[model samples]
Target: MKWFYDALNILGGISFVSVAVIAYFGKLYFERYKRKQDEKIKSLQSRLDLTNAEMKSKLENINHVSKAQFDKEFSIYHEIWSCIFEVADSVSKLRPVLDHFDPNESREERRERRLQAFYDRYNPLVVAIESNRPFYFEQVYKLVCEYRDLCRKEAFEYQHYEDYPNFKDYWESHEENMKLIKEVMQKCSEAIRDRIYSLTIIK
Candidate 1:
C-alpha cells in the first residue's frame, strides 16, 4: 500500500511539470505570433503611405502642366484677336464713310494709299495666323483665310476702279464687299467665343 501511494505522488508531480512546460511554450508561441502580426501591419501602412504621396505629387504635376498649356493657348488666341481687330480697322478705313477730298491727292494716289494701309495690317495678320497655324481650329482657320481673300478682292477691285463705268458702280461693289467682310468677321468672332467657352469648361 505504501509503494502504491509513493507511485501516485510521483505521477501527480510529473503531470504538474508537463502542464507547466506546455503552458510556457504556448505563451512564447502566442507572443511571437502577435509580434509578427504587428510588424506586417506596420509594413503595409508604410507602403500605403508611400503610394498616396506619389499619387499626390503626380496629380500636382499634371495640374501645373495643364495650366501652363492653357495660358500659352490663351496668349496665342489674344494675339490672333488683336490682329483681326487691326485688319477690321484697316478694312473700315479703306472706304471711309466721310471722304475728305484732298485736292493734292489724285484718285490713283488715294487708292494706292488705302491699299498700302490694308497691306500693312493684312501682312501682320497673315504672319500671326501662319505662325500659329497649328493652334487654330480648322473652321476658324478657314474663316480667317476667307476674310483675307475678301480683303484682297476688295483691294483689287478698288485698284481697278477706273475700269468701272461710273462712281456708282464702284461704290455699290465696294459696299457689297464690306458687307461680306463684316459677316465673316462676326462668324469668326462667334466661333472663337464658342471655342473659348469649351476650353473654360474643360479647365
Candidate 2:
C-alpha cells in the first residue's frame, strides 16, 4: 500500500512538470510567431509606401511634359495669329486703282508703291510661317499658302488695271477678289479659334 502511494506521488509530480514544460515551449512559439507576423506586416507596409511614391512621381512627370507641350503650342499659335493679322491688314490696304491718286504720281510709281507696301507685311508673314512650319497642321499651312497666293494675285493686278475695258469691269473684278479674300480670312479666324478652344479645354 505504501509503495503504491509513493508511485502515485512521483507520477503526479512528473505530470505537473510535463505540463509546465509544454506551456513554456508553447508560449515561446506563440511569441516568435507574433514577432514574425509583425515583421511581415512592416515589410508589406514599406513596399506599399514605395509603390505609392513611384506612382506619384510618374504622374508628376507626365503632367510637367504635358504642360510644357501646351505652352509651346500656344506660343506658336499666337505667333501665327499675329502674322495673319498683320498680313490681312496689309491686304486690306491693297488697291487695283487708287481712290485719290496724286496727279504727279505715274501709274508705274503707284503700282510699285502698292506692291512694296504689301510685300513688306506679306514677306514677314511668310517668313514666320516658314520658320514654324513644323508646328502648323497641314490644313492650316495650305490655307496660309492659298491666302498668300490670292493676295499676290491681287497685288499683281495693280499693273493690269489699264488692260481692263473700263473702270466698271475692273471694279467688279476687284470686288469679287475682295470677297474671296474676306472668306479666306474668316476661315483662318475660325480655324485659329477652334485650335485655341481645343487647347484651353485640354488644359
Candidate 3:
C-alpha cells in the first residue's frame, strides 16, 4: 500500500511538470509572434509617412512653377501697357505744337522742325510696338496699330504746304481724331487692369 501511494504521488508530480513546460514554451512562441506583428506595423507606418512627404513635395514644386509662369506673363503685359502710356504722353505733349503754328519761324522752317520733332517722338513708339508685337494679345496689338495710324495721319495733315487753306475744317478733324484716340486708350487700359484683377483673384 505504501509503494502504491508513492507511485501515484510521483505520477502526479511528473504531470504537473509537463504542463508547466508546455505553458512556458507556448508563451514564448506567442510573444515572438506578437513582436513580429509589431515590426510589420511599424514598417507599414514608415512607408506611409514617406509617401505622404513625397506627395507634398511634388505639390509644392508644381505651385512654384505655376507662380513663376504667372509672374512672367504678367510682367510682359505690364511692359506693353508701359509702352502705350509713354507713347500716349508724347502724343499729348505734341498736340498743341502740332495744331498751332509757331510765329517766330518761316512756314517752311516751322513745317520742317515740327515734322522732325514729331518723327523723333513717333518713331520710337513704332519700334516699341513692333518689338513687343509677339508678347501682346491681338486686341491690344490691333488697338495700338489703330492709334499709331491716327497719329501718323494727324502728323501728315500737319505737314501742309505753306499756303494750305481751311484751318477750321482741319482743326475739327484733328480734334475728332484725338477724341477717338482717347477712347481707344481708355479701353486698352481697362483691359490690362481687368487682366491683372483676374490674376490677383486666382492667386
Candidate 4:
C-alpha cells in the first residue's frame, strides 16, 4: 500500500508538468502568429501608400499637360476660325449682284473679283498669327466660320450659273477659295496635333 501511494503522487506531478509545458508552447505559438499578422498589415499599408503617391503624381502630370495643350490649340483654332470668317465676309458681298450679270458674265472679271476678294481678306489674319499676337487665333477661327457660312450661301447662288461660258473664269476663283479654306483647316488640325505632342505628359 505504501508503494502504490508514492507511485500515484509521482505520476500526478509528471502529468501537471506536461500540461504546463503544453500551455506555455501554445502561448508562444499564439504570440508568434500575432506578430506575423502585424508585419503583414504594415507591409500592405506601405505598399498602398506608395501606390497612392504614384497615382497622385500621374494625375497631376496629366492635368498640367492637358491645360497646356488646350491653351495652345485654342489659340490656333481661334485664329484660323477668324481668318475664315473675315475672308468669307469679303467674298459674300458679291453674292447679291451675282444674278445681275446673267449667264453672259465675263469669266475673267468674275475670276478677278473672286481671287481679289480672297487676297484682300487673307493677309490680315495671317499677319496677326505670324506676329504671334495673343488671342489672334481665336479671332481667326471665328472669322473663318463666318466665311464658311457666307461661302455656302454664295455657292448655292453660283451652282447654276457657274458652268456658263462667260462664268467659267469665276469658277476658277471659287474653286481656289475652297482649296484655301480646306488647307487652312488642315493647318489648324496639324497645329492641334503638334501642340498635344509637345506637351509630353510627365507620366
Candidate 5:
C-alpha cells in the first residue's frame, strides 16, 4: 500500500511538471506573436501616415493649379486629363496592382476600376508642371473630354455611330490621350530634373 501511494505521488509530480513546462512555452510563444503583430501594425501605420502626407501636399498643389487657370476651366481640365493619361501609361507596368483592388466582375466594377486606376496613376503628374504651354486650357479640356468619352465606353454601352461599324474609331480617338500626356510628362520631367540639378550644390 505504501509503495503504491509513492508511485502515484511521483506520477502526479511528473504530470504537474509537464503541465508547467507547456504553460511556460505557451506564454513565450504568445509574447513573441504579440510583439510581431505590434511591429507590423506600427509599420503599416507609418506607411499610411506617409501616404496621407504626400497626398495632402499634392492636394494643396492642385489647389494652386486650379487658381492659376481659374478663367480656363476647360484648358485646366484638358491638362488634367493629359496628366491622367500620362500617369496611366507610366503605371501600365503596375496594372496587376489593381489586383489589390476589388475584383472587377461587372460594368460598374470595370468603370470604377478604370476611373480610379487612371487617377491613381496620374495624380502626381498634375502637380509637376514647370512651364505653361500655349492654349493649354482648351487643349487640356479637349483631352479631358476624350478621357470622359473613353470612360463612357467602360461605364455604359453607347449607341455606335452608324458610319463607323467598329470600336476602332472610338478607341483611336481616345488613344491619343496617352501619347499626348506622355509628351507633356516628359517635358515636365525634364524641367523637374533641371530644377533639381540647379538646386544640387557641389560639395
Candidate 6:
C-alpha cells in the first residue's frame, strides 16, 4: 500500500510541472502578438499625421496666392487712376493758358516743352496698362481703355504741332468730358475699395 501511495505522489508532481511550462509559453506568445499589434498601430498613426500636415500646407499656399492676386490687381487699378487724374489736372491748367500764348517764339517753345513732358509721362503709363491687359477685369479694363483712348485723341488734337483748327469748338465739350471722367473714376474707385474691404474682413 505504501508503494502505491508513493507512485500517486510522483504522478501529481509531474502533472504540476507540465501545467507550469504550458502557462509560461502561452504568456510569452501572447506578449509577442500584442507588441506586433502596437507597432502596426503606431505606424498607421504616423502616416495619418504626415498626410494631415501636407494637406494643411497646400491649403495655406492656395490662400496666399489668392490674396496676392487681389493685391496685384488693386495696385494696377490704382496706378491707372492716378495717372488719369494727374494728366487731367495738367490739361486743365494748360487749357486756361491756351489763349495767352506769347507773341514771341518763347511761349510756343515753352508750350511745346510742356506738351512733350506730358507725352513722356503719359506714354509709360499707357504701356504698363497695355502690358498687363490680360490680368484686368474685363469691364474695368474696357472703361480704362476708353478713358486712355479719349486722352490720346485729345492730346493729338491739342498738341502744338498738330493744333486742331477748331480748338474753340472742342474746348466746351472737353469740359463736359472731363466731368464724366471724374465721375467714372470715383465710382470705380469706390467699388474696388468696397470689394477689398469685404474680402479682407472675411477671415
Q: How well is each residue in 1-203 modelled by candidate 1, as lDDT tens digits?
A: 88866876787865776798899999999999999999999999999999999998765544222556667766777887788888888877877768776899998888889889888998988888789888656677888888888887887887777799998888899999999999998888887776554453234
lDDT of 3 by residue, 5-107 (tens): 6876787865776797899999999999999999999999999999999998765544222566567657766766666676666555444634566578786
Question: What lDDT does the true structure give each of the candidates?
Answer: 0.80, 0.75, 0.70, 0.60, 0.50, 0.66
Write the number of the candidate with greater lDDT, choosing between 3 and 4.
3
Worst 10 residues of 5 by lDDT: 194-203
Backbone N/Cα/C clashes per model: 0, 0, 0, 25, 5, 0
Instruction: Evaluate residue 175 in candidate 3 and report its C-alpha lDDT on the 0 to 100 scale.
Output: 81
**Tens-digit lDDT track for model 4 on 184-203?**
55565565454444454433
TM-score-wise, the better of 2 and 6 is 2
Q: Residue 148 in candidate 1 has what lDDT?
A: 81
Give per-residue CA lDDT, model 2, range 1-203, as digits (tens).
88866876787865776798899999999999999999999999999999999998765544223556667767876887787777777766767345777889997897788778888988887887788888655667777777777777777676577788897887787787778877887787787666545443234
| Tens-digit lDDT string for candidate 6 (20-56) | 7899999999999999999999999999999999998
Please say which candidate is ahead in TM-score: 3 or 4.
3
Backbone clash tally (model 5): 5
lDDT pick, better of 3 and 5: 3
Could you arrange the candidates by lDDT from highest to lowest? 1, 2, 3, 6, 4, 5
- What is candidate 3's local distance difference test score? 0.70
Show where candidate 6 strays beyond 4 Å.
Answer: 1-65, 97-107, 160-167, 194-203
Query: What TM-score number comes out for model 5?
Result: 0.31
Model 4: residues >4 Å from true position, as ranges? Answer: 1-80, 88-101, 133-203
The residue pairs that clash in candidate 1, if any, are none
- Per-candidate TM equals 0.63, 0.60, 0.54, 0.33, 0.31, 0.52
How displaced is residue 50 in candidate 6, in Å? Answer: 47
User: By TM-score, how accurate is candidate 1?
Assistant: 0.63
